[model samples]
Target: MVEAARALFVREGYHATTLTAVADRAEVGHRTVYVRFGTKAALLRHVVDVAVAGDTAERAVAERDWYRAALTGRTLADRIEALAEGTAGLMERAADLFEVVLQAQATEPELAEAFQAGRADTRGLLRRFVESARTDGLLAETTDPAWQEETVALAGQAETYLLLRRTTGWAPEQYGAWLRRTLTHVLAAPLR
Candidate 1:
C-alpha cells in the first residue's frame, strides 16, 4: 500500500491521488486502506516514513547499515564522504515527495506538521553526525560545531537538493560528489 501510494503521489500528485486509486493499485480493498491509514494525509506520512527509512522495516535511520557505515569510517574525511553518499541517496529518493509535501501543506494541516517535524528530524541527524565527528576529533578546534551542523543540515535539505537538480541538471552522483566536496571545504575552511 505504501509503495502504491508513493508511486501515485509522485506521478499524480497529492491532490490528484485518491484512496480508491491507491487501493486499486495495491490490490487491496478500499476499506482496508482506510482502516490501515485512516486518512490520505496519514498515508502520505507513512509513504514519507517508508521512503526516508528506505523500507517498511521498523528500523530507525541511525540503526540502518548505511548510516552506521558512515559513523564507522576510519577517518573523518572518509566518514564525511560516506555520509554524503548516504544523504544524497536519501534526497534522490525522497526529494520529489518532499516537493509534494511543500505543495500540499497549504491545505493539509497534517502535512505542515509533518514538514516541520521532518525538518527537526533532519537537524537531529545532522547534530548526531556533528557530535560523532567531534568525538573522534574530526572537527578543528576553531571551527564552530553549531555552524557546521546547521550548514550541513541546510546543504543537505530537500529544497536545496531539488533546486540543484532542477537548475543545474546534475545527476545524483554529481550531487553526492558536490556534497562531499562542499563538506570537505566547509570543514577545512575557517568560518567562525
Candidate 2:
C-alpha cells in the first residue's frame, strides 16, 4: 500500500493523490487503505518516510567525511566526487518520495511539520560538522553565517541533478560526475 501511494504521489502531487487511487494501485479496497493509514496526509507522510529509508542520516555522515577530507588539502575534485556520489545515491532512492514530500509541505500544514523537522535535523547535523571543522582549524572560523548557508545550499546541486534527470534522462553516474565538477569549481579556495 505504501508503494502504491508513493507511486501515485509521485505521478500526481500530494494534493491530487487520493485514497481511492492508492487503493486501486495497491489492489486493495479504499476502506482498507483508510483503516491502515488513517488519512491521505498520514499515508503520504508514511510513504515519504519509507522512501527516505534512513538515507538522510547516512548522507550526513558521507558529507562529513567528504568535507573532512577537503580540509586535509585533498583535491576538491576527489571531495566533490565523494559528495556527489553520496548525494546521487540518496537522491535516486528518495526522488519520488521527495517530490511527494515537497508537494505535501506545500499543501498540508500537518505534513509540513514532518518535512520541517527533517530539514532542521539536517541543518543541525551540518552545524555540528562545521563546528568540528572550525575546532580542527580546517576552516578559518565558524563565525560567518555563510558557512551554514553553504551546507544547506548543497541541496541545490541535488535539485539541479533532478532537473537534468527529468529533461535528459542521464545515468546516475553521469549526473554525479557533472555535479562533482561543478562543486569543485564552486568550492575551490580563492586565489591569493
lDDT of 2: 0.63
Q: Which lDDT tens digits does candidate 1 get at residues 96-182?
A: 899889889999999999899888887788778777877887776654678887887888777778899999998778999999998
Cα lDDT of model 2 by residue, 1-192, tens digit = 977887788888888889999999999998999899889989977776655554324344324554455334344355455556665665676776766676667668888898777666645544544444445544433345464446434543435556787899876677767766654444444322
What candidate 1 gets wrong by more than 4 Å, as runs, is: 190-192
State the C-alpha lDDT per candidate: 0.85, 0.63
Model 1 accuracy (lDDT, Cα): 0.85
Q: lDDT, candidate 1, residue 52?
A: 84
Instruction: Give the range of the ten consecutive residues with the poorest summed lDDT in model 1.
Output: 183-192
Candidate 1 displacement at residue 21 in angstroms: 1.1
